[model samples]
Target: MSAVRGLEHVVTRLSDSCGQGHSGSLLEAPSADVLSCSMQAVVYYGVPGDITDVLPRIGEAGIAVWGPQDGEGRDMPHARGTVSYALTYHRDHGRYPDGSLMSTPVLEAAGMRVDWDRPGMPMPSRFEGFVHSCDPDGGHPVYERCSTAPKEPMSMAAARDQYGTVLTFSLGEPGSSAYQYFTVPRRQ
Candidate 1:
């Protein structure tokens, strides 16, 4: 099987049996410099066919896709979140005049590299251990953190907010990275 076929299969299986809806997204680390590419594909279950057309609306909201020559465009493929196979081919260049793709693999490969090394950060297994706790803010929960501390106690300091809430972090020493997370109440 092809790699994309495998990727599609994995994405499909993950979208099918796991979550509450038919939504899935992929995020890789390191973009812009091209050492790694962050890819995201999301499927929202029970959504209308129009639900999938949101990217263009977002484009209309003042974002531009620069096409293959300028290098900031996206070629979306296989975006069917409605009933099975409602619309097999749905690629629209609505807000982006130059946004189109002749091939999927070629476009996605623009950022994918074989020699990429995954950057490691000290991730928390639960919501705790975050120097500053905040809401999901708008991302998926791919990691957990300690409610109090990590499995191994590594010395890290906390910078508290005005309310005495911890909001930021700095490693006691260099050469270490952390996956910090937290929640902040909205100030209306």
Candidate 2:
């Protein structure tokens, strides 16, 4: 299937299965980028869909998609607890929003290497390891410790108000991807 067609198909499927309420946008990435020439589709299901069955179709489409890699130790057909599919798709496709990359430096400073191959810091699995500090000038080193073991994911606003940065990935239904990154913000 063509890239755009695949994206549209996926979005339609997600919208239909997830819920009646859904919204999405298609964005074009630079041709030089790894993403296909077609616009990258960003879809948000008001109620996240169960991808237990949809997972196989992603490979058939020959496109890269992403979402919460898995349900937080739960069975399939569960809503993602942390990261959004759009955020994951943007990072994988190198379409970064400003300040999103800030978390990398902060993670590195905390002695966590950014390695995707291993399951640890900098990876979504270890996202809860770091949180932002209100003191941005002092390098925002003051991190509020949250449970490393996945319990319930924190909301973006709650994380920002309390810790000044977010450090968690949603546990959502399965999808495809080329790469993925988190866009945690620091206090303004």
- lDDT values of the candidates? 0.22, 0.24
> Can you tell me which runs of candidate 1 are displaced by over 4 Å?
1-46, 51-53, 63-188
> How do all models score by TM-score?
0.18, 0.16
State the RMSD for candidate 2. 20.9
RMSD versus native structure for model 1: 21.8
lDDT agreement of model 1 with the native: 0.22
lDDT of 2 at 83: 22
State the lDDT of candidate 1 residue by residue for 80-162, as single tens digits.
22111112223332222355542211111221111100112222322222323422223343332212222332232121111
Model 2 lDDT per residue over 68-151, tens place: 244453212322221233224334442345533322211011111111211123224222222211111111222222222223
